[model samples]
Target: MNPVSVTDYRQLAKKRLPHFLFEYIDGGSYAETTLGRNMADLERVALRQRVLTDVSSLDLSVELFGQSLSMPVALAPIGLAGMNARRGEVQAARAAAVAGVPFCLSTVSACSLDEVARSTAKPFWFQLYMIRDRAFMRDLLGSARRLGCSALVLTADMPVPGSRYRDYRSGLAGAPGLRGNLRRVAQSVCRPGWAWDVGINGRPHQLGNVAPILGNNSGMDDFFAWMRDNFDPGVTWKDIDFVRGEWGGPLIVKGILDPEDARSAVAEGVDGIVVSNHGGRQLDGVLSSVKALPPIVDAVGDKATVLVDGGVRSGLDVVRMLALGAQGVLLGRAWAYALGARGEAGVTHMLKIIAAEIAVAMALTGCRNIEAIDRDILAELGQDINSRL
Candidate 1:
């Protein structure tokens, strides 16, 4: 069957990838309560449709960080994306360029920053994780600057990695023992297509960004260990000053849920703030990004561009976020699912689906342009959801 929605891509990805890798992308931390809430709360938002409105010329274009985007959507950074397909990050970057959207590459991605830069002429964004090594961090910042990255997304939520039960069960965590190795080998043997396309043909399986720091022969186990040892637990707002000193381009601080943090980010001089909960992969019981968005928007929307990411699956969901006062929305698992399912073609297809959906939704809601979307376009289902926020 042909895939039509992001969820359809997810299903296809599950079938094509090894079980452990699929769960790593699909599962959330702990009981995944916040993960489930992200979508559930978005579904609760109802759009106020109107008839007899002139919707002849629909404009979905949005200007962000001095760049014109075809739509108010971007593909979020996902680590180990190369494991999904043959040089998956490069493929996804090319797709994002074709779709005229920013593609943020993770510091832990399978393709190096230079490799992706050489693959596409479009200026992509880079997501940074504040590691313990100051020298390595500086080197990464220099590389991004040299590569002409349009933006630097500093993730602040994961001071420490969340305890994902699925990772443990799938043997992604814990020591790499003989049994776990055998189990992974057996799983790879079963998924011959994945093994051939990504495992065998997609050589240089090491984390491209950190391979120099951990040596050229480093593998998944070494990457995990490096993460455990390097992710600084005592990161403070002062680190923002350090990053600002290094990166002169557009700076975005991701993983913000609280209004206070949003305020602090503005004071720290970030150009944009992503009101996210790490897609519920980080704190499981925290408020969903949708629920947390309004306050943050009210707090810092004027000072900095407010973007959101969490459980945003369809074009209508993007509309909901825009109506709630977000400048744009970042999609994490959606594009990853597409890339895993059908590589570059799947990503391009997914973007077309979402763009078409957004246009249709805007027309149905009496919005002739994206800038006209506001809270007035929303109606309470039964209770005052805005009051709750």
Candidate 2:
């Protein structure tokens, strides 16, 4: 099929990936109420069409964290991406660099910080997970600095891994060697191209950032056990202060959905905050990140850059998020699924499609720059808070 949108890439990913791995990327927590709502709430937002406006030359560029972005979009940190494709993190980073955007590498990624940075000329961002040991966290930050990372994204969610019934049912958490091998073989038979390239020719994946502290988890259950024991639930704002003091660079707090928390991050001096629910993987019944964006944007009062992730699948959804006051949007599963489907080329295509859509949307909405998008668009949609979110 000819892919023209992120959803088309998702269909390709579903066809290429093993069922268990596909479910891991596609499924959410519990009943997935929050997952579905994320996209639905964004769809509820209405855009105003203008008949007379000179948008002949549109500029989607924006200055974020002292970096001039070609467009107001960044790739969110996604875990276990290497399992989706061989050296997937590096592939995705290269794609982001080609598209002129920042790609945040997750702490749990199969590729190392140095590896991803070496793969791209652009300064990629690094996402950190505050483990139970402060010394380890310090070492991780030092490693990122050594790799010349431009930003530190502290993921505050996942103190404990959320319950995913699909993984449990598929036995993905146990019997890693035999079960995983068999599953891959079967999936490769289904998608010969992906199998020959990723499954056969790909190198053995390792978690580059954490390989020193913890070995590559051979079994899913082993990984879950290690994570449950090591993750620090007692992490507090003081931890953020310590990281900021150590890094001395742009520090972005992710997984924030509350207005008070956003305000606190600003007062405590964070450079940015991403309004996300861990892509609906951490919490089940919480409000969608889009629903939480308005209040958080209001609370920050322009003190820090505000970005959001979760259910941002299309260019129109990006428009809705910007209209709701988000400074930018994060592409989570969008790029990951694309990489799984067609390696680097698929991701590059996905980025271009979204960019063109944003430009067209801006032209139709009577807005020239991203900053011109405001709450006024909501009035034209006849949308109320209760009705939309």
Candidate 3:
């Protein structure tokens, strides 16, 4: 079948990937209420289409952090992408390169930063996790700088890993010590392609930037233990200052919900702030990132670039986010599904489809550029979205 959209790629991914892998990418935290609400809130935003305007020469380009982007949309930092396809992170980064957009590599990626950066033609952004060890965190930032990373994204939400039942059942999350090693071997045999292509041929599963701190295939349990011990629970604005001093580059603080946090991020001198709930993977009952964007946009004013990521699947959702005041949008599961479907080719196709969709939406709405989108074009369909935030 010819996959022409992200949804099409998602359908193909479900068929190609194992049940557990599919669920891990597709499912959110327990009950998935926030997951479902994220999409619902985006859909509730109705576009006020304008006619009789010449949008013939539409400009989707956006200049962020002094660099011009082909589009304001970027690929969110997705973890363990190597599990989706053979050398999946490399493939996805290549796709982002071809699409003329940025791809953020996660702290928990299966493929190392060096491998992904080497595969792509352009430099990409690196997302960092604030760990308890200041020295280890410093080393990770230094590695990113050495790799010529364009930006440093500090994810602030995950003090502790959320309980994902899907991963637990898939034998990927909570395992029974060394006994689970036997189970993993059996599962690998079942998925020979994954075993041979990713497990055998590709870089071994390890956080590339943190290798000196956490060594190779230390098993999931030990990794989780490391995470528990390393994650700084009392992360403050001072830590943000510390990172800024060390990196000396564009810094983005992700996982911000409160408008006060957004204001603080701007005050702390962040280049951008991502109004995210960790894609609904961390907190369940919290307001969706989309729903929380307007207030943050209002709070920060023009101090910093505001990007939001959560339940962002379609081009229409991208438009809605812009209309609500996001400088850019990020995708997590959408591209993950594409990577799972046909590796780099699928991801490239997905980007093309989204670009085409965005152009169409812009033409219909009488907007010629991403910067023209505003609150006047959006109408809320559900409970007062303004008050929800």
Best by TM-score: 1
TM-score of each: 0.98, 0.95, 0.94
Model 1: residues with Cα > 4 Å off, grouped in runs: 381-384, 387-389
lDDT of candidate 1 over 65-184, digit per residue (tens): 998999999999998988899999999999999999999999999999999999999999999999999889999999999999999999999999888898878876664767776777
Backbone clashes per model, in order? Answer: 0, 1, 1
lDDT of 2 at 4: 89
In order of lDDT, best first, we have: 1, 2, 3
Please write out the lDDT profile of model 2 over residues 1-389, one tens digit for every residue: 98988989999899988777788889888888889888887777778788689998888889788888889999989888877787889999998898888999999887888888778888989999889988988888988998888988999877788887767555565446677657656756777766667667765555667777666563455566767888988989888878986798899999898998998899889999999998888889999988899889888987999999999998778888998889989999999889888888888999998899998888888888888878876644344353556
Q: Which RMSD values do the candidates have, in order?
A: 1.4, 2.0, 2.2
Deviation of model 3 at 172, angstroms: 1.7
The clash number for model 2 is 1
The candidate scoring highest on lDDT is 1
Q: How far off is residue 337 in model 2, in Å? A: 1.3
Least accurate stretch of 10 residues (summed lDDT) in model 3? 380-389
